[model samples]
Target: MKSKSIGLSPKSFYYGYDSKKDLKHLVRLVLILVFIALLTGMIGIWVVYRSAHERHLDMLRAFANTQGDVLDAYMLLDEVKSGRVHGDTPHEHNLDNVKELLLKQESFLETGQLLLAYEDTSTGKYILIGTGHMPSGQHSVLVVENTRELTPSMRLALEGKEGVLEGQDLHGAPVVTAYLPISKHNAGLVVMLNQSEFYAPYHRARLITLGIGVVFVVFGTWVIWSAEQKNLRQVREREQLIRLSFENSAIGKALVAPDGSWLRANKSLVNILGYTEDELLRMDFQSITYPEDLEADLDHVQAMLKGEINVYHMDKRYFHKSGDIIWSHLSVSLVRDEQGEPKFFISQIQDITERKRVEFENQRLHERLMDQLSLRRQQLDTASGALEGFAYSVSHDLRAPLRAMSGFSQALQEEYGDKLDDTASDYIRRIHRASTNMAELIDSILRLSRTSFGELNVVSLDITAMSKRVVENCRVVEPDYPVEVRVAPGLKGQGDLRLIGSVLDNLIGNAWKYTHGVENPLIEVGQEHVTLSEQSDDSVLAFYVRDNGVGFDMAYSNKLFRPFQRIHSDREFEGSGVGLASAQTIINRHGGQIWAQGQTGKGATFYFTLNHTQFDSEKNSTS
Candidate 1:
């Protein structure tokens, strides 16, 4: 039994409904297939064109090689005729015969001209000896006695290598060339074909392939259009959705007219500026921009309009509706119409007021920190001056008593040496030695203080000459001590002359002292390449003094630069243990580092840098 209809009849309900959604899916599938077909066609075109171009290049290379072989044979024959071996230079008459053969062979070549050139080893010039074609109407070959710039292929041939290169010929026309050297004659043969003619066939084939691809694309587009026309109502629905998305975007987006007037703005933009849509629509960007920032913003906008730049981003300030300033990062891009004329600008903005506030606070803190640093620097200067004064006082007031003790002890030894007992004489000698050691310690302290306090006098110094003079002084001071010193020549650096001289004296003296009692004592000074922690390149100069003398254990290397830290006893080394320490202090003042490497009873090498710019106190001296 038929039931009573609850709503409209079935035919009425289904009327005017054609399921256009399914139609859209079908159209999309068709379009995709068409695109694949078009892509395949285009790829085929590229493969054909590339294959043809390579084939032509290979043919040219083969022809060039054959011609080169013939030319080499002719050159060899000429050399033999001139009563010379294969490698000897050919005579003028032999060169003339080779030139005639080259000119004769040029007619047989299908698409290229030939040239013979020899490189003048003395002048580094490629001198043309022969050419198949003469200069006419800008189509020319290099002439005899005229120079030609060497191409990569030509340069390789000059070095007795064969190669091919694509480059510009002498007439500045693009060409592909093959170069082969005539080994015995010290010359080369070059075959050049115009690139335009070489690629003409390939270009024609590429055009045909592209034409087929275009036809397929056009037909696919027609099918898509016809199918799309049947879905007008669905298209309208999509348009509404797009509009809604534009209005509800989270980012502040706007379309501004070329005249800087707001054409459309999203809800996010309205919320950012605290302005209603109606209010914003009536205002232009220039009206709300902070006065100081408007000029720069306008300059970028004009530049975009003139095509100097495509897009720009700037941090800008705008007046809010409530009269407060709002900071934002504004990114703008110019949009053009189909005719390529200025249409409008698409702008995206993000609020940056919080970031700006943090930046301002950081700047304030930085200024405060700089002020504190300046105040501390002044205090340090005052303290350093006080210390310098104290050192000077110690130098004068402390040395006077030590001198008296030394003088009295020496007087007793000389005046009463025979009368005094042996024990008494021994006590007197002990006092004299103690006084001398104390005097040496005092001198080292004063020198260390001076090096730390004085300003550096930097200049270009001849280090080798300075080292030689220091060695000379050492020789005169200790004539009996047999020592051999070798100073490397041409060693120069930028440093203070007097201070660096002191550094050399101390180092050389230590080397001379330590090498005592050894057979054939030797010292050598030279420079080496060094790498610093902060620099990636190993270009730092490490000037070193090496000696074959009695060396200390590596375990004590850390204490080598500390004052009063001695590896050997006073009787063994006869030093106050302050010589190396003083040397280190001088090097440090010159913005340099000093390090030592040694093995027990073997030898020692002291390496240092003169232009180091960093000083870490932790690494400067040993505990």
Candidate 2:
């Protein structure tokens, strides 16, 4: 038997369909939806109305209680003024005040009023003592009806049953009112709000809900009918979209037969291979694939046929129609028939020639940079060794000569004193001092160099204790100097213990040395709060050593940390000038900073910061 394509023609597909039955079903569904929508809207409207009404009643209850309290207050005041409790006749002035207060409150509401009434025992009727709508200066009058004819709210209040309810007011207008009895004053208070004003919002909500329900019904019904008619067209459009996507794709796409022959190719594939679709269909993938990549491609194909894999992806090279090799990222998937027989392959290819070229160039550049870095590291090692040798020479070889010179000068001065004049003795003393200074200078240079070169041994340090120890050492060296030193407690930091101690020695010792001659000398060691940046909440702790001493000039403060630089004369204060410089280097090695602030004879402060420690400013009470 010959095989036949089982497909429906457009004319038969359209003409043989029963749309009327489907339309009837859709109409029924839309009607059910509209009914549900309307029912929901009605329930929503009712909910809003009840909620608004209850809220109004709550407000009315509050107002009635407040008015009752005010009336009781006035009655109590009147009783006190009359020299009795619950006087039979209340003060008339107090009544007038109550009426004025009620009138003022009435102005705040729209269609709202307050009524104060007391029952006449003999007539069994209520007498209005005050009303918000009354004339300003009018006296009490019989404005309300008898107890039987009074409004429900007022009757309830007279009976001492306090509550809020909807009823008619004295003017026969519908209203919501709160009623409370002031038993002490033998009167009742009624606060009324017009029903129309209170319910306006609820009515607007109902109307809006109804309008929305109607619009929803009409729009929903139209949408259901239109969607039903467009279903067939959408299916057709989806097929067209798939076709257009395959043709307009930037990457190459092809369908190949199980025999490795091209069954179909898209325009992008034709462009990539520099061939027409008809020309590609006559060839096989193996003919265009580079020889180096052909074996791998064939392996993947064979494995796919044997059910080892459903898809394979790889970067491979292919020979274009122009005989140029191109790098491509290729993805292939097998499509099988329902009976598990191999049908064809779907291949997607992306050209990656430029990407491969850039990757190759970067690989070469990386290798070159690595070589240069190795050479530079070797050179730096050689220089560092040379520097170490030079420091050894300065510390040992040069220092020995200075010591000899100083010893010879002292011996000459002591042994030849009788033969020498005053000028010669002065010359010998100067030579001894110079030799001592030079030796000290050399030591300071070595200390400064070591600060920058050593590996940091960071550990938790009690900076407060260190500062105190430095201060105690100063007192031991100069026992007569009576200076007050205060080190703040809880000053903790993280840094190399020996290096940080050295920094403290320089800073605190300098403070002690400079405060020698000043009366009532004082030194303070504390941490200051320093924020890293305005935009960041992170902060660093900076410890400061402050002193009351002969401070240096602010203009020359920049020279304080330079090697051998001095802002003061040697006769006034002695220093090698490398202490602050060494302190700065140690701080920098630990990722911190150091600076000084001073004036011309008032005081000076040296501040230094350390990494990885945050201080609480509240604990800092030193200065």
- Please give the lDDT score at residue 613 for candidate 1: 42
Residue pairs in candidate 1 whose N, alpha carbon or C atoms collide under 3 angstroms: none
Candidate 1, 1-623: lDDT as tens digits: 11112222322221323446656776787778877986887787778777876777777767768877877777677777766654434444565677666655534344467767775555555556434344542223354442336556666676787767898775577878877877766777677777777777767777876787678777777777676665655755665576667678887888777778776777999999988776776778899998988999999999998999999999999998888898999999987766887767889988888899899889889888888888888888878898888888878888999899999988888998889999999999899988888888888788877877777899898989999998899889888777888999998877888889988988888888889878899999987754555556434568889899998899999999998899988878877777788788878777788888899888899988776542232225421
TM-score of each: 0.51, 0.52
Overall lDDT per candidate, in order of appearance: 0.76, 0.78
Name the top lDDT candidate.
2
lDDT (Cα, tens digit) per residue for candidate 2, span 466-522? 998998898888887889999999998889999999999999999998988888999
| Counted clashes in each candidate structure | 0, 0
lDDT of 2 at 66: 78
Candidate 2 matches the true fold with a TM-score of 0.52
* Candidate 2, superposed: residue stretches over 4 Å from native: 1-240, 254-265, 269-348, 355-377, 411-419, 531-540, 612-623
Top-scoring candidate (TM-score)? 2
